[model samples]
Target: MTGTPLLKVRDLSVGLETGGGMRPIISDIGFDLAPREILGIIGASGAGKTVLSRALVNWIDPPLKVTSGSVVYKSQNILDLPAQKLRMLRREIAYVGANPAGALDPTLPVGQQIVEKLRAVAPEIAHEEARKRVIDLLGAVRIPSPQMRYHEYPSQFSGGMMQRALIVDALVSNPAFLVADNVTQPLDVTVAAQVLRLMRELTTRFDTAIVFISSSLPLVSDAADQILVLAEGRVVERQATKALVDTPEHPYTRELISQIPKIWTSEAVAIDLPAETRKPIISIRDATRSYRVRKRGTFASYSTVRAVRNVTFDVFPGENFGIVGESGCGKSTLMRLLSRLERPDSGQVLCDGQDITRLSGKGLLKFRRDFQLVLQDPFNSLPPRTAIGAIIEEPLKTHGIARGAELRDRVLSVMREVGLPGTLYDELPLGLSAGQRQRVNVARAMVLEPKVLIMDETLSSLDQTEQFKLLKLFEQLQAQHGLTYVYISHDLAMVRRVCNRVAVMYLGEVVEIADNSRLFFDPGHPYTKALLSAVPTLEERRYKPEECLLEGEPPSPIDLPPGCSFASRCPNAFGRCHKQSPVLTARGNKDLAACFLVENTLSHAAA
Candidate 1:
């Protein structure tokens, strides 16, 4: 690391245009990034970390302007730079935002897009050379089969994969500095670890100074050399990663630290329903979901992608059941089946012991009233033009449950239940913050008074404080309404906190199933253990490099390996593991794991 700084910000403040003139968003934010240094900027969702990042790059869009700030890059004030010079500066300083989908061009192939970006920045580079660099960068980001994935569009990639692709895009130009805005938020722990490792490698090899922005303190603390804590758009605390984590001086910083979910410790108490209510509220019996995708070159010939393969599990009444796995592991696909948004190709989806997989017409419509789905992106899930009141009331109206004053009363009641202010009832969803929008989503879901609520990565996008608040709200709602939740997420830390029973899935198969404490603390499956170990914690800044690091990306669900789906990556895989698939069997007193090693251990103990 050099004494000379790569980027410097002084007295930075940003403002948004409002009816009452300019309103301050971020005020008096100051920081410096030295060569090869990682500065982690962490705060709640609206804390203006993103605004500061955008200001540093001079990329703040209209209505949100840099009111007072001087961002200096290599002795040059970026805000004062001319358009052409600014463009050149941007080539040396890249920014990757939280939303990868927005960064990418949906119409173009991802690889082609990267190549285009390379050529745009360096016009002297040949197409062939740029293409090679694109593939190499993709590989560097741990994207499997870069050659094939290069030709695929952004739509074809999962959220985590898309985020990695954006990272590659940022690094493609070999920028001297990078602003990684919540890059690891969507990724599973394993992938996030790999990405962070790659970023560290870049800093060491190329001296790329980075500003790693995130909502989670522990996550950034693991990767960053220095930590800057922001609250209400101001820098509340700034310290070395260790110093900040060891003893956060600010109350907000301390509260943020306290909220981070720890896998090593168990604070979760299983919510036990009465014996009569403990029966399966929702059951998936050998459910399979497949999609036909056209071959790379030929439109006529298509191959089947088995997203969910023979997945079976039961969600008991009044209990939070979690399904966790890496991206493309069928967690979301299975949730869709439970929500009746998609029908399974085979097997049955039983609700209260009655098959609802093939329900249609009135049957399907009526069945929907019994359950609701809360999606990952609440803003997208809700209609932009519709008022929050109408959005929440639509479900109740569709079910023919109420109307007129009664409908408005029910909507207001549900809104209150989700902690949404009554004043915001007539306001459009666009006017609400991310957390508020999510609350609106929850209110809409609850308006029908559904017995089952399927939350598919709902809280994954929110900041830690918002997530904690929503989690608490979920518990209260469950207690008050007797709601049974089917929570599907890649966030194991969250799963550990909110779930009563948890199931670990890999490539569409359930590899492990146990109570939250057992699954996280004493995972029987190697894959489960690896996932848990990958999670970053304040106690351990860096996980042991050699321990529980997965070998490669998960094999394609379209053409899975002959034996176990995770066998190739499993450290304990043997001859039988390669030849045969292991079924979920008892591994401990109350846990089930689909691993030959676990089975062998159990057999030896019995003998």
Candidate 2:
């Protein structure tokens, strides 16, 4: 490493103004990035991960002005630099993040986009080489069929593909440093793992200093040499990744670590918790869902894809059962089916073996009362026009249960349960912080006091402190009211702490079901193992790719493949796995793992 910094951010303070004045989001925060080094920045959402990243690039918008700080990059003080100098520095020494919407002109083809970047940075380059360099950069980011993809517009590509193209565009200038902000957010686990691997390799291959910004710790843990943990715009912890993960000193950091999504592939609970005291409320029996998709064209043919195939599970009364999977793995769709938010195209969703899948009207209403859902984004889930109190009372009004004075008391009580006081009852969700808005969403869902709360990434956006409070509150609520939870999230570690059993979903199917202990300690499915491998550990300073990084994008669900849903990507894939679908078979202690490998290994153990 050189003596002087590549990018030095010193004593930076950012403020959040409300009502009439400014409050600090980041306070006297400082960090550095050296040449050929990678720095991972982790913080709970709204803890200033986004704020600090923007500040580093001088992208922080007005009303959230920088109070005082100097961002030194490329041998000059960036904050002190004149606007033109700063702009030049951005092109010469550093590259701000590539916003997919902002990076390329939407109407133009992707090939032209790459050329524009090259021409912008080095106008002297000839047309032939610039175009060739476009293909080379495209290949560098692992975009398949570069020739064909190059001609496609940004709109024609998937979110993942667009992100990759943007990454290519970002690096076309051969930047000395890279600041990647949530570049992997839109991708599924397999693709995300691939993207992370590519970024690490590119860093090593190009020797570019990088400042990686993300809300996910494990995602960045392996890739970062040193981690800068920020909270409310202040540096909470800065240390080597391994030391931080092994013995996280900060209370906030520890909570953040514990909140990662815990995946369940088989039915094995590590420890006994005070479980709920009721019969199995929801049951699954060979349930599956398939979809038929048709593309936009004059002669587009309809195609069918089988998503959830022969899946079976149970949701016990007052017990939390978590469902985890990559983006394309059909978790959200399955949850929606279970809650009757979306009707299944095939199989049965059994409520006490009554096949609630076929119910409607009164029967459906009764079933709906048993379970209520809260989506990932509360701002989207909650109504903008409605006051918090009214939103809470809406569910009760629909059920025709509570009225007038009685309903108001219930709403207030639920709000208190979720840490929202009476003062917030009439507040618009717009002004409230992300955490507070989520609180209102939870309060609204729990007001009628449903048996099961289906939270689809409910706490994804909150900072550590807020997430901890909410998790603790959830535990308290479950214990007090005997509520069953169907929590869905991407944070595996957090899932382990809260849920007793987990069902692992992949490509629209439950590949494995296990107790939290067994799944984390001895995951059976290849995909499960790969998922665990991708999780960042503070203990390991250097990035290591998954033992078998899943290969290929998930098959198009519209037309679907036969046999195992993971056949296309599974590293241990055999002829049988490719030819025949595996069924969820009985393992000891009510645990189930659906791979032929697990079946073979456990059977061999028994023999």
Worst 10 residues of 1 by lDDT: 536-545
Model 2, which residues run further than 4 Å from truth? 16-22, 44-46, 80-174, 182-192, 215-218, 242-279, 539-546, 558-562, 602-607
Whole-structure CA lDDT of model 1: 0.87
For candidate 2, give the lDDT of residue 368: 81
RMSD score of candidate 1 (Å)? 1.7
Residue 487 in candidate 2, Cα distance off native in Å: 2.4
The deviation in Å at residue 37 for candidate 1 is 0.2
Report the lDDT tens digits of candidate 2 across residue range 1-607. 4556788888898897788788988899877788778899988666777777777777777788888978888767766677886667655454435235556788988988778767877889988888888887666555655765677788766445787787777777777778888776545455566667766776777777888888778778857888888776678898888888788899988878775543332333333444555557788777778766553343668656566766778877756788887765667778878888777766778775578878889988887877788876655677888888888888899999899899888888888888898987887777787778887877877887788888888875554556777888888887787888887866665677788788998867788888777777777787777776665443331213545556555666654667887888787889998788887766777788888987898789899
Put down candidate 1 lDDT per residue, 1-607, tens digits, no spaces.
4598888899999999988999999999888899999999999988988888888888888899889979998999999888899987767899998787677889999999999988999999999999999998787777867888999999999888899999999998888999999999888888888889888998998999999999988789879999999989999999998888888899998889888876665478568676753679899999999999998999699988888888888888888999998887888888888888888999999998778976899988878888888899866788999898998888887888999999999999988889998998899888778899999999988988889999999998998889989999999999899999988888877887789899898888888999887776678898887887777776552235477778677787777898888888978889999889999998656579988888788888999
- Which pairs of residues collide in model 1? none
